[model samples]
Target: MIALGVWQLQRKGEKEALLALYERNRAMSSLATYPELPPVPDELLFRKSSVVCLDPVRWDPRSGTDVKGRSGFRMIADCRTGAEGPGVLVDVGISDDFTPPAWTGGIVQGTVVPGPEQPTLVERLTGRAVAARPMLVADQPVAGLRQSAIPSGADVPNNHLAYAVQWFLFALAALTIYIFAVRRRLRQ
Candidate 1:
């Protein structure tokens, strides 16, 4: 448990560094370059860009919340950009419907955000290197949907310091109990 607490503290430091990177990069002006393919670097997150989605291949409905925290579904679409490399995943919009939105394809301006995690443990073990592509969160919603929440790095949690403190308290309590028990044993 004590080791676990220490590990969590280490993880907290790493998380803080990642958050710092997000804050620094997010503040920069929008990039002059827009990707034709994906696997965008973590450094590019939150920078505005325009994506011209030529063809929307598939739509994925994910349970998500709006900027106001209202419960809904985000319609993420796999787009065929007519580029040579991998296709892009664009978050079309949010809606109460689980069904795919009626949007076909168009140009949209939004921030470059992290994409969904992919390639499960089995895939990793199998050596399937399916890289998770970064997604474009559209600034405007599709005709029948609402704009999705602009994700922030603040959404990630860092409770490691608190966990370390709790572990230290537990160790102290155990030591105190042991000392008292030893004293009673000696008296008896």
Candidate 2:
């Protein structure tokens, strides 16, 4: 039990360190300074960036929420680093109304993130899919929508601390029970 408690404490420390690293990366500046799309480093996830859209904007009916907690669908589209290059997926913003916006294509600034799976609950919500692997989250709000809330590592729940305390308590209880058993045996 004591060993288990120690292991949990170590895990707690590791989780805290990982969370700190994520925060550091998110706080870093945009990668948009690059003239061309550079190879995305793993540390660049959630990093802000700007890219030009090469295709028409598509709406992914996947339910999304704004920073204000307003529920809506995400506006996604294909973006390119250059006119002739391949494109990447970019989520522009959240739209409360179902109607598609008049946005054709242009330069957009936002954060980079992994693409979320299509929402399973609403089958009709699924629209034309883009081929971009890692998706970009636009920083600006869409014409008739609000800015999509960017995910933060701080949102990740780290329950390791609570788990460590539970393990320590169990260890203490076991030790006390053993002491009482020894005392009873000696009395007998």
Most accurate candidate by lDDT: 1
Tens digits of per-residue lDDT for model 1 on 82-132?
766667788888889888877779987887887875668889898985766
Give the per-residue lDDT digits (tens) of candidate 2, residues 33-133.
Answer: 42333344457666777777766635555678987888888777655546676566777788877666777777888777766643354554566443225
Provide backbone clash counts, one per model.
0, 0
- TM per candidate comes to 0.78, 0.62
Collision count of model 2: 0
What do the candidate models score in CA lDDT, each in turn? 0.82, 0.72
Clashing pairs in 2: none
The global Cα lDDT (0 to 1) of model 1 is: 0.82
